[model samples]
Target chain A: MIPTIKNSKWLPLCDVPVLDPSSWRQVIVQNVREGDRIAALFGCTHNASVPVRLYALLARDGQGTLSVLCTDVEKDYPSLTPECPQAHWFEREIFEQWNIIPQGHQWLKPIRFHAPYASSTKTSPPIGEADFFQLLGNEIHEVAVGPVHAGVIEPGHFRFQCHGEDVYHLEISLGYQHRAIEHSLIGGPNKRTLPYMETLAGDTTVGHTTAYCQLVESLAGCTVSSPLLRLRAIALECERLANHIGDLGALAGDVGFLPTASFCGRIRGDFLNLTAELCGSRLGRGFIRPGGVAFELDTSAFHGICERLTSVSHDARSAIDLLWNTASVVARFENTGTLSQAAARDLGLVGLAARASGVKIDVRKDFPCGAYADEPFPVQWGEKGDVYSRAYLRWLEILQSIHFIIDKQERFVPNAVQTQIGNLQPSSLAVSLVEGWRGEICHVGLTDDQGKFAHYKIIDPSFHNWFGLAMAMRNQLISDFPLCNKSFNLSYCGHDL
Target chain B: MIKSLWTRLKQHHRTIAFPKQEPRLPEKFRGLPSIVQSRCPKHCSECVTSCPTDAITMKDKQPHWDLGRCLFCPECSRACPHGAVLFTDDYRMATRTRDNLVIGPKEYGLAQPLEDQRRKLFGKSFKLRVVSAGGCNGCEVETNVLETIVFDIGRFGIGVVASPRHADGLIITGPVTHNMKSALEKTYRAVPDPKVVIAVGACAISGGPYIDSPVANNGVGNLLSVDLYIPGCPPHPLTILDGLLRLLGRRYSTSRR
Candidate 1:
């Protein structure tokens, strides 16, 4: 039986007994096949004599348990991708970071073309220059787009192998925005650390910072006040509301639905404005600190937000409803880019994209933390994994999130905002999973013997779902690529980090 | 179709009346930061230490803040016991010269428009190609906001085009990453001669938080000559709009009566 840690904030890495490499692989493969998703898989090197220690964090959604299984490996180990397809990227990442190869792992490629952490033997290949799977037939032409695009979007390369208008395969190559954020966090909880977490993924500032703060607080054995936790939940849901609204607007824009596109865009700013009212920044930066929150809401400020939220919610609902009622929008959305439920499960997709594929997994509901533990939100899913379902799922989530925010506002109690965070426990590991607007944002922090961060692993939801976007494009029309892409709206920098 | 037309008509003119009137910013919105030199204690490094981006430096024993490099987190303001650093709601922080970004005790003016021949050539209609080398999508989204109904930058005859070849200038964002260095250079080269590069946000000016990172080359300033520097962690849409308008020698009358 794999040793399980109840989802809190931090757990001692030593409490998770290190097994032999073979047993570790067996445990992970068996558990993952039995429904557990690999949350994070990373290696940490401590001493010169000791081998690199590998940690596998498995999130058993049904049980609300996070099981930690670790092993010490010298060079290489048998691959788990053949049995569990979710292990494909994780194994490749392990290989890229430590020079330990995953034997028998098919489709071994660098996830991020960065220099290896431990060794200097193999020079890192240039970004987006890796060998991609090519189609070898007449009429099987390739179309490459970005690290730069027409729209003012983040940089990431997309290679599509197409037969006429129908796309046979699409390979997304990122790492253009890999800012060495994780590497910078080592031995740091310093002033620079929180700022790094805030901008880890700019749009998901609250989500990532919350995860980082939670991990730090958990490591320090500190619990924040209920009011602060409630406010954070509200801010997080506000972030959700804004992004979902913006995404819905973007989806409409993709289909040439002008009314919803224009209206939703302005309404999105309204929600962001509400966040600005809470904190100074629209993106919710510097609001979520280590122990708790940086700001507190006064009565007038609180009521102002409540009043603004009501109007924005009404306008947003009206704008989004037009999307469903309009035939042209629905026609473009439905069956455009579909990912099967089986494929979603195989790929280990999370968040809204996963839910759209009928996979009932939400970090907030499954593994409740802070306010979620007290007042949980319902799990919303869609049967069809098409662009339409994803759009509809976002709309559904927007309504639910609005209701959640309004409800939280009514029940909010004024109290101390931030608590004092003590020194972190040495040789401990903390895993924080936040359901960011994009999806599950996992930050795993392992502290050294000196109570400083030894290795920091940040697994953005984009990491799991970017592959799902690629899978969705299979047999899809080339023109619908933009629509399918917007439905996902995966972060380039988030994945790159 | 009639109902849609009526709906559109009822919506009326939704664009913010800028260049004829000042835009409305939220009360809590942070913009230009002003430093009070006298309030700073002698040899106290509180504000300097609290600054995340190292934007604040002590020169002549007075803390000078580089707006281009600032994330505007307000940590320095909170860290200072004497209340030396204060942020104003004035969203006009963009500047023409890099030195102008370093604010001491004295007040600084807005970025002046180009006096070159290219300004007159492109003043009527300036098309820009935006390149996000290593942006976090904050600046990208805000830059996109300029095209939306409320902002609607097209009225000024300034718009973002897809290709650099068809553009008059490049409005670049993000810290230039090593991976995107070649792509950014290639895109810049594609733009015709007499093109200006306007670096937006702190990242594009000084790499923001990711400045000394091995993976990043700080900002586009290192690679290209920046004509205008609009500063913010991610500059508010209004700040960006004002910067663009000011750069074209067009200023909106203040709506305040």
Candidate 2:
């Protein structure tokens, strides 16, 4: 049986019995084959004498259990990608960080083009300069887009091998926004740590910060108040509302649907304004700190939020309904840039994108925590896996999230906002998963003997879903690329971090 | 089509008449930070210690807060027992030079207009190309909002163009990372002569939270000559508009008290 641990359970790092490399491989492969998803796999080193310890947190969605298994490695280990395709990126990341090669991994490449954490003899290659998969043909032409683009968007390179209008294959090269966030996070739970989490992905500030705070609080053994927990869930859903609205608007804009496009843009701000009502910042920054929430929602503020939410929900529905009603928008959306459900599962896609492909896995529902445990919402999914499915899923989620917020608001109980966070449990590990706007945001914190963070691994949902976007573009028209991309709306900085 | 037209007609004109009127800001919305020299007790380093980004420092025996470096978290204000550090709802925090972003007890001037010749050349049609070096989409989205129906920055003829060649200036965001360094430099060089560089958000101004990371070069100021610095974690859209309009020497109305 795979050693399973409850979510947010902080246990001594040394107590996680380490197995030999081969048995470790057997256990991981077996668990993954048994319908488990690789939530996080990373390496941590405590002393110079011992080899780097590898921790694999296997998430069994159906069971609502996380299996934490680890092993020590000196140089190389057998790659699980052949059996478990989801292990591809995680293994590549492990190799990149610790130089522990995943033997027999077919396409071993730099996940984020950055220097290894520890001093290494291996030379670091410049980011975006790696060899790309090339397609050679008589009539095939290559199209290379930005690290810099025409729009007011983040930088990342895209290479498409095209035959006339149809794209044969597309490779996305990122890491232009690599800010060394994960490396900078080591030995820190300082004043800068919360700010770092808040900006890890600027748009998902509440999501990332909440996950970070959850990890920290769990490690520090702090029990958050019920009201604060409710407030956090509200803020997270608000973030989801804003981003979903913005994304739907962007999708509409991409399809040349002007009415919904312009309306959703302004309406997105309304949700952000509501968040600003909750805290000071529009993006819900400064609202969530380590111990608990930094702000309070009084009766007037709660009523104010309700008033705005009702109006905004009405407006958002009317605006989005136009997209479904319009023929032109539907024609462009449906059957365009479709990712097969099989491919989505293979790629280990999470959150909305995965759900759009009919893979029903939501962190909140599967592994319930805090407010999500008490105030449960049904998981929403779509079957088509096209751009339309993705867009429609977001629309459905926005409506559902609005209702969820209203329900939580009506049932909110008054309690203390914060509690004192004591010193962290030394040499312990804590894993936290928050269903961010994009998807599942996982943060793993491992403390040394001194109670300082030895390793803090932040896995943004974008990191998993970016590959799904690339796969969706296979055999798709080059013209539909932007629409498909906007549907995904993966975060470059989030992935880079 | 008729329903759409009717909906559009019924919708309120979303654009705020700023400069002519005061833009509505939330009560807790933080903007320009002000320091009270008299309020700070000697040897009390509470505000400095509370600051996450080291934006607050002691200079000339008075507390100096760098707007460019501040995340606008209000931790400094909350940490100060005597209320030495305070944030005002002043959205007009954009300035012409980087030095102007550093706030002390003495009053500092707002962003000045371009020279007479340059202002005449591009004031009515200031086209900008935004390059997000490593910005976490916060600043990028806010910048994008400027073009939306609500803020409608295009009303002043200050629009974001598709190409750097078409732009009269560049509005840069994010702490310029090493990977994006060359691209930023190339984009900067691609713009024509007499072109201005505006750094928006704390990251673009002073690297924000990732200030000391090995991969990041801090802010755009380190690589290029920045003409304007608009400060916020991600500055409010109105604040961004206020700064851009002020720099262009275009005012809708007199400043409100």
DockQ of each: 0.73, 0.77
lDDT of 1 by residue, A241-309 (tens): 989999999999998988989988888888988888888888997688877887778766787788889
Error of 1 at A430 (Å): 0.8
Best by DockQ: 2
Which regions of candidate 2 fall more than 4 Å away from where they truly are? A413-415, B36-39, B252-255
lDDT of 2 by residue, B1-257 (tens): 87677666655577777667787887778877887767778578899999999988887667887888899996888788998777777878888888878887656768888889889988999999999988688999889988888888878988989899998999999999988999989998999988999999999988998887788878988788888888998899988998889888985333556
DockQ category of candidate 2: medium
Model 2 global lDDT (CA atoms, 0 to 1): 0.86
Interface RMSD of each: 1.4, 1.2
What's the lDDT for candidate 1? 0.87
Candidate 2 i-RMS (Å)? 1.2
TM-score of each: 0.97, 0.98
lDDT of 2 by residue, A379-496 (tens): 9999989998999999889988888888876666654557879888888888999999889999999888889888899999999998899899999999998899999999999999
